[model samples]
Target chain A: MTQSPSAAMESLSVALGERTYPIHIGAGLLDDPGCLLPYLAGRQVMIVTNATVAPHYLDRLRHTLSGADLEVCEVILPDGEATKTLASVERIWDALLAAGFNRRCTLVALGGGVIGDMAGYAAASYQRGVAFIQVPTTLLAQVDSSVGGKTGVNHPRGKNMIGAFWQPRAVLIDTQTLATLPERELSAGLAEVIKYGLIWDAAFLDWLEREMPALRALDAAAIRHAIRRSCEIKAEIVAEDETEQGVRALLNLGHTFGHAIEAHQGYGNWLHGEAVGAGMAMAAALSAERGWLTGAEVERIGAVLAAAGLPRVAPAAMGVDDFLERMRLDKKNLDSRLRLILLEALGRAAIHDDTDPAMLERLIERFPRA
Target chain B: MTQSPSAAMESLSVALGERTYPIHIGAGLLDDPGCLLPYLAGRQVMIVTNATVAPHYLDRLRHTLSGADLEVCEVILPDGEATKTLASVERIWDALLAAGFNRRCTLVALGGGVIGDMAGYAAASYQRGVAFIQVPTTLLAQVDSSVGGKTGVNHPRGKNMIGAFWQPRAVLIDTQTLATLPERELSAGLAEVIKYGLIWDAAFLDWLEREMPALRALDAAAIRHAIRRSCEIKAEIVAEDETEQGVRALLNLGHTFGHAIEAHQGYGNWLHGEAVGAGMAMAAALSAERGWLTGAEVERIGAVLAAAGLPRVAPAAMGVDDFLERMRLDKKNLDSRLRLILLEALGRAAIHDDTDPAMLERLIERFPRA
Candidate 1:
């Protein structure tokens, strides 16, 4: 399932006025210096990656950034969602300081979502921010995390409790890196692809249902199209609302429920995409409960998630109170009200902070469990 | 002398377009709820102060915020420049989460620069940017740190290595708080006050020279005028360059040399203003070395610092290389060049990055030592 080396690259910009940046999607972009060299803030570059991703892409990136007057260094951290802490970010800062890297230095995030997030935060706070470029290897990162400027680490009580809204100079998504992605992780990535369709485009949702098999089979064309379209929708939304002030919260259709699962199970046990998969289903069911979505539409969503090999049921051990408590700590909530993203219909979503507590409890109580 | 309780409150605005905020200077502002209540983003408020200042003003602040429907909480950190670390900021974040404070909550920083910096960073990162107000008690904070949007903690390698440019909703300067400040600390704060005069206004510098005794004696009118003028100059510069891209670097006239002294002596020992005082003298001497100022002008600068009871020499133990190594890591530097802000005359300062390394070494080697 190797992508053709000659596949043309697609470039799109996340328009944020003065902070606008490009998202470059192609096969073998990591091996091409042209994709990375222009975005380097200066001659100094620090590549931040993790153990799980280093053996595969670190050397390739180093080779691409080699030659010339560049002072390139690296900080290899431990892998997994559990390892996404401020301590790990500190390691990146330590390495940067040890190398005497200046504010002009550029940080290249060379792994999946965890690496991208930590590296982005390191860039955000390092000497009050330096330029950074994202080289996402995971499908989930390419389609979601890497595109948005949301960068931070998980706090013990709540996820992403400490972070800043720092955007990158560019996002270089080399689709070829997905060759080594695990099956579960690939399915996890599809959960977000399905999400964009559920929230923004019903037509794209139809395209996804027809193309899920090809997407799962690692068909290069299907994968590239999925990544590109996902990025486009995200860029459009981010352009409209760069800081999640209004329309952007619609992007978190399943995140409240998903974060609950992740926190309850400890971070690494349930993959973010897996939790998102089940969470989206729960959101769909709730939408149906509110009469905004039809029962058949909810069933359609569940089937597509199943086709993508994502969980469509909540973790059996999680009780209604477990979900409620974790969701209460969500960043989206204002004051006392529980703000949620609910679908009005396929491809359209809205924020609902007035959901009846008893009805929400009933929905969670009767929700199917795995 | 006690400031008249009926002294009229003077307010000015830091014009940053949509992010513009007001700065109020008066007597007994901490006890005035009308000053603090309007700036709160929501009903939730967290008061962040240090142990030393808490006993003096915490209860007064709590009382000011108590009567409303506000859910007010507080996190009192240990006092000292040494306590300005990420760990302390984490404690603030932890307190906010434990209290169930949401995105719309506001944080009120009530102490010196260290407390304001940590609390501001906490507000900046909590839920990815919450509202915060600055209630600076120390003279140095009132004149300098609280007015600027710069907030962060010091890393072992460098001061303010991790931070963000986060502005506050308002800055409340209670002139009466200075009544309880230690003489040594008051002198330390005057170092920054002298700085405002030296860097931007020669007439102000002359006025400071004449009024140093009144300022040191805590003349109610003299102290109030100095704080207001210093803040006015700082706010004008900050509004012109919020992120330190251009004119803002002039504000660091003596900071490069000062930071080296602080790092060598350890943070709390030298005090930031003391270091800056000596650093300003060093900058004046170097300006003479570069023919930008006459020897008489340089001597005048040193004499003024001494009049304010601030040091005019680097630490005796620090060698030439010790100064160079620490100053090289200063945030103002661009790439490999050591960017220094040096006096051009009695009041004007400019950044010079092409200073001869040998000349800088000789300046440090021959500079007076305490």
Candidate 2:
């Protein structure tokens, strides 16, 4: 938090075998064409964004890409999670084909996680795959979805129920975009930032505890440290396991329950990071009950999430039975057994599949809206 | 043709480094559940078939898969090249979600090329991909589409214009399924069988010339030989180039013109093989005009395709301009320059981007429908 915001750009690489890509993080990175031009293998590029994002940044992106050789197009989608559907993806497909985009074309996803997932999946499946780059705008996207190459859309039954593991050519995260982020979203994104500290770096948790005010106030130095460090932790885990065959599942700390909440609340009602914030609280409560974490450790984790203005309880209308039914549909479940990532301690997390249902029911009851 | 059909099944492996898979060709393979059970990594299996192929084999496949441990379901699509569309794929997505299919569910494609492509694409995108096995029932699929992991749906603008290069766990080709293939389809399948010979194997071309009668009659031994040899040739090329960067493009010898014909004729009017058959003739004519193949050699190749009842000329309604427009839309194109696969000589093919347009126009005019 002591350094200036524009000190120097940091680059991290996800070490997937052939699909390895770099994540570039800094302030005002988007102002430089050098950051984008090298990734374009061809002259045709399509920028995909949403109504909320296009007016703010699409013109600048177009200006940066205004070379005579480059033919750039944009497809603006409606903002929100509800818009991440097969029908919306089909619009992208039709737009690309109608514009005569082929395998040589590259799609640029320039918005939040929904746009990245939708555009990435479109790029993955378009003509058996084309090249794509990610310019993730939201904090949640910059640190999480944009890096791992997990691209997909939600099904009525579940979130991210249809997708492909297609990696982007590169992920360019310009932290300056956070200036335009809404307050609710800023706090929502902080939930994931807190998650990195909780799940992998206990020492970082202490840093966040001390600098909670700086982070909540959107101090550029504090934001940069949080994003770069969060990305580094994620990169190491992804390098170890790209496709979630093993250790990668640890990244889903609150996601299984988070996805259930998002789906139950009708997608756009609650932001993804918000649900995850609340869901992480429930997991912490459950972890304490399982004897993996002390009651004091759980409270410490809760205090940090609360400090970031995240929800401290689950929705009162959602009962344990609803979560149980929804969780059964989780992609991580093996056969019919539910698997969850829970805190083993303040900074360590482990995937557990043997939690007693009765105990889970009691844990849910504890998180009343009041 | 000398060996007994049931003596033993032949297995060929596609050497794609980490994505390598086995192609198993045998008589009565679907009759034995053992051939399929090992490939099922999970208990849930969804058989994607077509109306034409289901009545003949669905019950037998179900009976064979009648273990209490396995949960089997079917999504039967209308049987035709026209059925390969984004709309059809949506039906598959909805069906899988409704049935509670997740990442572990294995999709078995149980019909012809259309079903295999549609179902394979479904498996590729369903929850970011799941394990899928190919049980190709058509000779075209058994030898070509099923062996290579190219799965997709046709866009209204082009054939296979939307897809992903997702590999299957294994491919099972049952020679007995050819017994139910219509005469026209059996002849159409021979077009691709002839392609392997024309593009790579001169001696196999000679063998196909000798066995043309037996193959047309659906003789079991001849069918088995043709499928095995075709699969072998395809496996070798695919092993060399899985994603068609260089050597794999050689496999699309007649496909550029063929795809144009398929697209121009509205996808189902002429079978894929029939269009390819005619397209190959056009390619041979173009190759000879370019002084690559002898005029006599061109006629020899034409006579073999003619022997299989393949059309000798492009449809009269399609003018040279129509062929040019459609071929420009081929996946092989780089930017807007057209690249095509042409014969250097019998059993040897090369990708050519410098074909003289005037010469191509003259060649098209030679193929009058009358």
Output the number of the DockQ-best candidate. Answer: 2
Please write out the lDDT profile of model 2 over residues A234-307, one tens digit for every residue: 99998898888888898888888888888888998889888998889889989989988888888888898889
Error of 2 at B256 (Å): 1.2
- Cα error, candidate 2, residue B309 (Å): 1.5
Interface RMSD of 1: 0.9
Least well predicted 10-residue stretch by lDDT in candidate 1 chain A: A1-10
- The TM-score of the first chain in every model comes to 0.98, 0.97
Judging by TM-score against the true structure, name the best candidate.
Answer: 1
lDDT of 1 by residue, A1-370 (tens): 7664435899999999999999999988988888889888888999999998999999999998886579999999999998899999999999998888888999999998999999999998888889999999999999999998999999999998888899999999999899999999999999999999999999999999999999999899999999999999999999999888899899898999999999999998999999999999999999999999888999999999999999999999999999999999999998878999999999999999989999999999999999
Against the true structure, candidate 2 reaches a TM-score of 0.97
DockQ of 1: 0.77
Deviating ranges (above 4 Å) for candidate 2: A1-7, B1-7
Q: What TM-score, computed on C-alpha atoms, does each candidate reach? A: 0.98, 0.97
Model 2: colliding residue pairs: A128-B163, A163-B128
Looking at model 2 chain A, report the run of 10 residues with the lowest lDDT sum.
A1-10
